[model samples]
Target: MTDFTLLTVVVLTAIALVTAALLIARLAAPRTFNPQKGEPYECGVPTRGEAWFQFHAGYYLYAILFLIFDIETVFLFPWAAVVGRIGMQGLLSIVFFIVVLILGLAYAWRKGALEWK
Candidate 1:
């Protein structure tokens, strides 16, 4: 076989071996199930009812806003790191990015997405 084919076979074999070993370990492990174990354990507090429940839409809206601002913060770090090397062009680009981000925040504010109630 060609070198590439041989390398591919070796990699596939390694993966298959690992998978078989994991399956064997799982099968050999003990199986124990009890009423307490199946029930939802909430920090030692007994569950009252079904775990599934409807949450407020406001919570989701706030989460989305938080995510947007969080992503903006993430972008800022990388831009700050390369600002000196990129010089004027990078500075201008970052300014534009900040402006756009601010505009989005303004829009959200105007739409009352920032309001708690």
Candidate 2:
């Protein structure tokens, strides 16, 4: 076989072996199931009420807004790091990106997504 084919076979074999080992370990582990064990346990206290609960729409809206700004910050850090190497074109591109980002935030705000009450 060619070198590439040989390397591929070796990698695949390693992956298969690791998977089999993990499966064997899992199967060999002890298994225990009881009525209380299946139930949710919180801070040594028995869980009360329904496990699935609906969250307020406002909470979700705030979370989405937080995520959007958080992601913008994340992207900004890397771009800042490479700004010198990228020059004016990169700066303009980032400006455009930020403008688009601001527009999205504006749209969300206009739709009342930013309101707490």
Candidate 3:
């Protein structure tokens, strides 16, 4: 089978399995409802104030930087495995990629994105 057909079958099978599991759980699970369960916090701890609040931009910046470096490893592993066959060109390309990554990290560092406070 073609790749597209294989992907479609896999996706459909995943969806079907998830749906069947959910249906089975709903059918088999016991239901017990009480007045205490209707509260926002079922554990009985009272909320002090509004739960929603604006978060700092540094939090998002830090998380994005983390994800960028984290994804770099995903590319690195495959490149390392086939480095011998790819020769000088692949080595140079990865060097360039690493340089870019270093530059991005430096930029983020200078902008205080790495700072916790």
Query: Each prediction's Cα RMSD?
Result: 6.9, 6.6, 3.7
Against the hidden reference, what TM-scores do the models get? Answer: 0.54, 0.51, 0.61
Q: Record all residue pairs in model 1 with backbone atoms less than 3 Å apart, i.e. clashing.
A: none
Model 1: lDDT of residue 40: 89
Candidate 2 lDDT, 1-117, residue by residue in tens? 999999999999999999999999899988788878887778768888996889778998878888888899888999999999999988999999999999999999898878777
lDDT sort, best first: 1, 2, 3
Score each candidate by Cα lDDT.
0.91, 0.90, 0.90
Off by over 4 Å in 1: 1-51
Model 1 C-alpha lDDT per residue in residues 64-116, reported as the tens digit of each score: 98898889889899889989999999999889999999999999999988888
Candidate 3: list runs displaced more than 4 Å.
48-50, 66-86
lDDT winner: 1
User: How many clashes in each candidate?
Assistant: 0, 0, 0
Cα lDDT of model 3 by residue, 3-117, tens digit: 9999999999999999999999999999899876766782678655665788888788768888999999999999999999999999999999999999998998898777788
Question: Which wins on TM-score, candidate 2 or candidate 3?
Answer: 3
**Candidate 2 runs further than 4 Å off:** 1-52
